[model samples]
Target: MPTPAPSASTPPPAPPATGAAPPGLPPGPPRTPPAPPSRARRLAAPVATLAGVAAAFAYVGTVDPNEPGHYPVCPLLRFTGILCPGCGGLRSAHAFARGDLVTALGCNALAVAGYAVFAVVMAVWLVRAVRGTPSRVTVRPVWWWVLGAVLALFTIVRNLPVGSALAP
Candidate 1:
């Protein structure tokens, strides 16, 4: 027996075509990767960062942290009577800004190392920006743990009489 045809009130259903856009949505233009930033634009961040750091060092160099009432006392040292890893960071920066490496190291060896690292990283960043190449420094989780351990050790040692040399 032949099947009955649909009445005029109902139309025949159509199947969806393969790889076609959803129902009524229009196809979008071809996607393209964004263009790299201009050399000046890339350089802007590093230069601004350097400028800010320089300003901070300048301010620190001008105001002596060694004097009483210049900068706020470290709450850790004030309340807990413990020297944190950053206890003499300002003094170290001040000495570093004044080109006195020995004094900077004497104030805070760890902080002096940090300043050196910052200088090196900024130099690398500026160089890459000038060359129109992008650079990223990805530190691993292990390094962070190591850094934390080192800071803890530094704090402990600096508070000991034997580590008086490390004290501020």
Candidate 2:
């Protein structure tokens, strides 16, 4: 027998996409979106993270890394006499906390750049957290490789006489 076709005035609505089951199967529960987190819940992590960072800076500011006995010498510097990317990070942080931007950059320009990037990211994260949106950091693999290459270059150049300015 031939089936009769309906007149094409209005299109058919899509069937409800939930709660249907195969002939022998039981129906499953309906789908729902999870509720967004509460304001305090959303803010907690960003706030705590900022507080911890602030505390660290405060401690670094109080304790001078220039005083040899206060901080440990970089193992790479001590053993191999090679300056790593993070050779003067603590001293940089100490200078930064004391509001000596020039000295901070002089101590470790890369670390100072990192501090600026961290500040910008944390500010954005705090704003997003307050607005009840989750903050996510997504870097492409290519960018990661580029960053690694940049670091390697920094490490290499800092050790060379031509890049003595970059050395800590």
Candidate 3:
């Protein structure tokens, strides 16, 4: 293979060769750092998330999950007669929101952990937003797979008689 030739450094590439440079240092205004969010954009996502969480909490809070008609039953429970890891999560959240820790744990321990994790993540998000920094979340693919496997195993084990404590 042939090597590329180096160019002369004496003269920098001409802008167009036809137009003259403007009166001051250059034509354009002095480059400024990017502006932070305006009032509306800054509050939008957080407000929406808060509203959604409030709505979810309200729905779960008012409606009893034990009743058949009030909430959609989990298909796994209905058809397979087995409890999934997500089972009783609504009841758990309702109990949690109502300040009943024992009931919440009886419902689903993992769901409580999820709520705490979500709170932490949202706190980070809010801090970043206030600081005018971009909010970002990055998880490795391996972590994703591991999380999936863990949830699957938890679901399977929770349904078994041997792991009755894990059951909702």
TM-scores, all candidates, are 0.81, 0.80, 0.77
Q: Across residues 1-168, which tens digit of lDDT does each residue of candidate 3 receive?
A: 985565685565546323444656455544556787775687678768978998998888888776768888889899989888899898898898888988898889889888888999888877777666788799999999988998999888887788788777
Q: List runs of model 1 lying over 4 Å from the truth.
A: 1-23, 26-29
In order, candidate lDDTs are 0.92, 0.90, 0.81
Q: Over 4 Å off in model 2, which ranges?
A: 1-33
* Candidate 2 backbone collisions, by pair: none
Cα TM-score of candidate 2: 0.80
Superior by TM-score: candidate 2 or candidate 3:
2
Listed per model in order, the count of residue pairs whose N, CA or C atoms clash below 3 Å is: 0, 0, 0
lDDT of 2 by residue, 5-116 (tens): 7669857765655766666887666677788889999889989999999999999999999987998899999999999999889999999999999989988999999999
For model 1, which pairs clash? none
1 or 2, which is superior by TM-score?
1
After the best TM-score superposition of candidate 2, give how far the Cα of residue 14 lies from its true spot, in angstroms. 16
lDDT of 1 at 22: 72
Global Cα lDDT for candidate 3? 0.81
lDDT of 1 by residue, 2-25 (tens): 988999998887655454467689
